[model samples]
Target: MKYLKPWRSDGGGLLHLTILLSLAGLRLDLDLDLCLLLPPPTLLRDELLLGCDPTSPAYALSPYPAPGGWGRADQLHPKGREADPAAPPEGQLLREVRALGVPFIPRTRVDAWLVHRVAAGDADGAHGLLGAAAASSAGGVGAGVDGGSQAAPGGGGDPRASPSSPLAARQEEKAPAEQTARVPDADGRASEENEVLRERHEAVDHSSQHEENEQRVSAQEEKSLQQKNEDENKTADKPDWEAEKTTESRNERHLNGTDTSFSMEDLFQLLSSSQPENSVEGISLGDIPALPGSSNDGMNSSAHYNVNFSQAISHDVNLHEAMLLCPDNTFRRDPVVRTSQPQEPFLQLNSHTTNAEQSLPVANLTAFLPFVDNQMRNLTSEDFLHDLNINIFDEINLMSLATGDLDAMEVSQLFQEPDSDSGLSLNSSHNSTSITKSNTSHSICEEGATGYSSDPESLPHHNLEGAVGGNYPAPMGHRSDSGFCGDLAFQHVFHNHTYHLEPRALESNSESFSWPEKPEKMSRYLSDTERNLSRDERRAKALRIPFSVDEIVRMPVDSFNSMLSRHYLTDLQVSLIRDIRRRGKNKVAAQNCRRRKMDIILNLEEDVCNLQAKKETLKRERAQCNKAINIMKQKLHHLYHDVFSRLRDDEGRPVNPNQYALQYSHDGSVLIVPKELVTSGHKKENRKRKREGIEDGFH
Candidate 1:
């Protein structure tokens, strides 16, 4: 036997002892009933199967073959054998075993136990057993017997031979039996060895069964947790579903309850019924039932109900019918006048008639009197008709003047007064009363001439005076010394026809008597501004205002105030002047505002049209660009295929189109690269870009 070196006194010593026994040709099979003798199947299998002896053919092919060549005989003898220089020291090996957290038995103790068993007559055909056990112990818990034996040439162990593999148990049982058969062991010792092996196998089986049970329990727990989460999600969604259902129900109820259709007549009725007294008589909005799901707040609920009711009523009513149902006095209607026979051409002048009336030609006077009398009679009945008749008479008078039947000089002479000094003073109460009575009697003649009964006593004297004064200008050019009837006449005329008279007529009539021919037609020729100025002119004339409406409106505030101060004006006249100025300014402002609004509207419309055109142009351009892009894409696709099909590798063989692709660089260069390489490069670039974008965002 080879003497073991002091360095090989640990696990290496056992390995050295096993080799010595093998060289001595001993078949001592020690049936030691110690757990240490039956090494763990995992360790035994690793040493016997995975380990390569220097004598084995597998060792010669191994990448890490032993330094010196050794045959089967040499392996059994191993002259001048020493521990492998590559093996760890005893202290390092112990530390490694401790790091692995495995139970470690000292080799000296194991060897001493083996010697004790041999001395006790236990070494029966157990040489092979001892060698296998010693080899396993020397290898340590998971150490390889040889440097390159732990893994295949590929540098990894076989997965099928792993310790945890299901077939490992069967392999473990077979390995022990094979080792036992290698030596001629007694049947009793063999049975005891088999029993010990059986006990160890059962222990491994029990541990595996425990791990499977734990896995099953974990799977059940995960299933329960998932089911609980799903139930929670369902419960959370239930309220939302119920709320939606309620909303739908309310909508259905609202639709079913309300009426939407209406007619024109109903609209009319609704409008007529809107009067304060009648509003409550119709169906009250509050009487309508509230809709389902509506809040029960006080004012809000009532307001909502009223709004709904009003909308429903408006839809069911007509405008015309509503108007018809309105009170008769709500709107004015004209009375129907019956046409009577034409009156006789006759003079029925009263004794109170002025000399101006007496001098007129009978035929001409008769033609004028009846019409004037009719107009005066209708004044109280319908002012519109009275004004219409006046306009008509003015037209007739103009035609008469054109025909030379009525002269302007003749008309002016009528207001001259036959006896200037003898004529009654306008200030005389008796003369004024008489003049008013004569005018009333002249107008009343329509009834007398038409053979109708007259009532001079019942006729209102003031109405007759106002009728004469308002309708016609008093005789002008009356000596200024002859009372203030001109002012009175102007006041009345201004009150009635202020907006109608021409400016020339107003100025001329104010100073002297001058009847312009076709004066009524002059109004038609006036521009809109002139018409507006004329209206202010009339108002100024009525109030006896000294300044023109235009100057009042156009003048600066300081100028206007100075003008107001210069004039001796009553509060009424001053108020009237200010009103005229305000009205004139408002009118001009309104006109300018309307004009600006029209310009703005036109500008907006033009902009809208321009924008629409621009939109259409852009759309067309985009379409053309897209079409060009599509054409380019098609050409590029075709070109790519053509180029790829003709591409050749370094060996002059046609490159596979599917395996290679064309890539464009930022510098506008195109290159052919492997498809997989391009795909992986693109993935990396995308990830880098994404990471950079995220970082930029944080910054």
Candidate 2:
């Protein structure tokens, strides 16, 4: 029996060729659309049983030309040898042959050479059924032959003597004559002859000349085909550079007409040119067209149109000027004149018109027309100055009173003006006296004169006598009378309360007016810091707490206790103080807890977001792992089928999976046993273990 030489020196001999052919057959079977259209298990089982069974009819007759003859005449009786009349049956002979371990010819090499010859002879028909069946069954038949060969010595018998050798050609020429001379046996046992005779013939014809010639021809054909395919692939892969360049040039030409760059000056010029000719800068009041409702019959229509047009033109001009002057480009229009009294109708159609009709003003006309240039020119500087001073004085008085409380010193400082030698200073003293008297009378009436004595006996014989009589005394200084008037005015402004002025207004006035250098005596008249206090603070102040309201509420427990010990406070005072402290702490704690709760909620939201992202990532990973597992399972299934299909019994028959099952041992060796036997053996083992456990329990 010839043993399979898997590690052959000459390019891995017949065993390697068998494996390659088996792999090629598997690839072709897998590629068939029939596998997708049919159930996978059923299709795979049919293909494996049909293709891998060496005894199948498809593989019974070797595709290669036998050296002896087509019917094995020479193998049965070599050189006119007589046949035995009492020869055993074909099955018995096969069993006997296998038992004896006789070597056979290397049919794998012969089949491969036959396929090559057929392919060379008729290239167009090379893919026919005969070629396909031989390729598919090559591995299984080779494995059987290898097993038989291993049972006998010199299995392959020769290194050379391939099918393409001249010796094989000579045998082919004599095959026809031998076939004619040979007679068929009635029992059909001729085909059952031992393959030992063919092996002997192959061993005798081990020559190398014809094999070398065939190898050289086949190598030249393969090299030329490969080189041609590579050249074709290179041409197909190359890009058309010339066409691409032409396309790019065409696109460039299309874009050449448009300019993409522009300066800021160009944008400004374009915007200016886009403006209308009748813009506000070019149009005047005279240019405005009269409305269709205006009449030429009376001066009233003309006057009304003039008023409306002037108002419109003035509004447009003001907006245009503001846009050009202001950095923010915002327009601040003048306030419109509003009147409480009713006016005559623009067109008094009749003298008997009702008062309601006469009172209705024109829809689009201004309530008062703008003053003419002549009227404005008639206004003197003194009149303007006087009006300006009165407005300033009113604003100061209002601002001082807005806080409803003002200290005596703050009020005095507010009205004090800077020393200047202008003629306006002379009249300031006389005007200041009247202003102080009026403001003092108003403050006394409104605020109940708590800081001053209204009695004539307490009044001082001075210009500010009515203003700060008992509350504040006028400061004595070398400053002008304007300074003294300012001091008197401020005393009346603040009265006996604390007042806060706008910081901006205070700063502007401070630059012009200087405060009295000696204001120490004024401090006694100013109210205590308890002014504008909350009810609790006022009550605490009235009770005369030694510590301030802030210290009482915010001090630590030990400090508060020490403060109480030092003060000798009543029980009522102590209880009230403790209540104030507790309320303040609770308010602060509530604010902190609200902030902390919001932070915790935000952190939990962030955590939820992160966990959701992680869940998505895990879902994606699980999907990928499942896909990989399915792919691996498919490959493992194919590998299992391939291995099982290669298994054979001692009689050289393919093992049937229905009767026998393949199992793995603990040592990792594969063992084939009948299905029923495996199940019975497992059952017996389980029963024995159970019985042993019971006996151990009893013991």
Candidate 3:
């Protein structure tokens, strides 16, 4: 009777399936050694056991306590079983234990795990191993329970009697034998009651069996899922591995490029064979096929196959041999002469010849003089030697002048016209050709001279000077061992000429020439400003800044703006504001002003809050005082009523005010505020406020 409701009613069929699904999804991958217990087994077990009343002593000894009756009164202890406020039902406890044990029930666990892996497509043996471990453990515990159950049915039956005592006989005599009797003549009422009890027990047992079945089915489903996972993993790995291998093979093919049967070693031999045996250093020739439309007759083919040995020997060939493998003339064949003169037959300065051109340095004129000689020697062979001699002397003067040789003037004067026929040949049919030749020759002569822009009249009059100054004339009043070259050359020319004149040649022969003093100065046609600038440059001093108020006033506004902007004072508005404000109030005072503004806004909000709080506090105080006053009034009224009732002659009536004075405590202190003072304070505060307002208007 103490069992109240059957245990099976507390559990449900869906419980097992829900637990199994949760177990499968849970992140806690329980190790075999940790066992099938919840994280905090004590807490969980106790919490889950709620309402089971395990703490009750009688219930603890026997879950279904002996039927409460008068006969068992002597056996019952004075302190009955204390019911536990928290205790789970028998079915829930059994299910929880099984949920924990499911992973350890060896045989079933191994089977489930293997099947799960297969269903889940996980080929790895990990799942099966873990499942087997759990299954074996649970199976052992379950087997132990089964063995004990077989050893003793109903636990020796009848929980009411002490099993070992001979007093049991007496207890049996008192036991309700009619409860077990199967008589057919029993009343329908009794029989129906029995049937009802039997049905309830059978229904509970059936529900428990259903729960067990659900757990078994859930385990089977999990096994299938695990197995499916294994299979899928195995299948996925196969294509990935094969794809990796295929990619590697394709990469190998791309790098080798071995479509043809020819090997790299054979190709190397053929390439080497195409080049000549005597090929120079740094030369490499590739195997070149024959050109299209080329004559490949025996003689021509022989020429194509052969190397130009003489041409190769004449120069150090730095070019690759692959270049020579092409058709004839595809590669250049000119000799690169690094140390010799040009082949134009011009006399060289380094040569040991007394000839004028041979004695002169060729460095300056060599670049320009080659073409004239080439053309002159090639045309009109009859005067070639004589013309060559005359041209050689002319080239010497040009070369000497080009190189700034000390003997340039002498050479130039020597080669100067013995007659008017001294200049370039004018009778040539090719004016353009002659002009080109003349320009080149003259250019060389001009570059070689001391001054490229020298005046012809000033040449003979020029005196010795340091060559560092670019001016061509030598300074006067100085004597050298050989005299200045220009002066010497001038004297030689003068003495050799047919015309003789006095020492002061210009004065005696005014018809021939005249000269002016201050010859070194530049032409007088120079402007005054230009002359003044040159004279000022000749002196060394810093120039003073030319300042004028008008110039400053005329300065562009853009220039002034640019200067202002660089200094970050560009905005006119900013400047105007700065000018007006000049110095702001002290920092502290400014800060205080800003603070006051913020405080006013914030204080406005705070004032409303404080006022509300004050109102609430006042309301609360008023309510408390009112409640106290009402309570006191009620007490006073009762006191007055009691006093009046005691003092009256039999009729109920009001009491004397002196006899029933109001009494109360406020804030833990006695207060005695008379009604008159309270009323007067209120009236005075109102009158004072009204008078102050009237006085402010009068002021």
* Candidate number with greatest lDDT: 1
Q: Candidate 2: where is the Cα deviation over 4 Å?
A: 1-550, 565-576, 657-659, 675-699
Quote the positional error of residue 287 for candidate 2 in Å.
Answer: 84
TM-score of candidate 1 versus the correct structure, residues matched by position: 0.27
* lDDT-superior candidate, 1 or 2: 1
Which candidate number would show the highest TM-score if scored against the true structure? 1
Q: For residues 597-622, could you state the per-residue lDDT of candidate 2 as single tens digits?
A: 99999999999999999999999999
**Tens digit of lDDT per residue, candidate 3, span 1-699?**
101111111111011111111112211111100111111112222211223333332122111112231112112111221111122223343344334332211111112222233223442332222222211111111111122122123322222222333223322343345334533221112222222122222222222323333333323322322233342333334454343333233222322334332322222233234432212111110011111112432112222223332222111111111111011112222112111111100111111122233222323223222332332233223221232222222222222221222233333332342211111111122223322333233333221221111121122111111111111111121222111222222222211110111122212121111011223432332234323432112110001112122222344557544533433221111222222222222334677889999999999999999999999999999999999999999997887567545553226564454443333455576333455665676699789999999999999
Model 3, position 223: C-alpha lDDT score: 33
**TM value for model 2:** 0.22
**Given candidate 2, what's the lDDT at residue 34?**
12
Residue 366 Cα positional deviation in candidate 3, in Å, after optimal superposition = 40
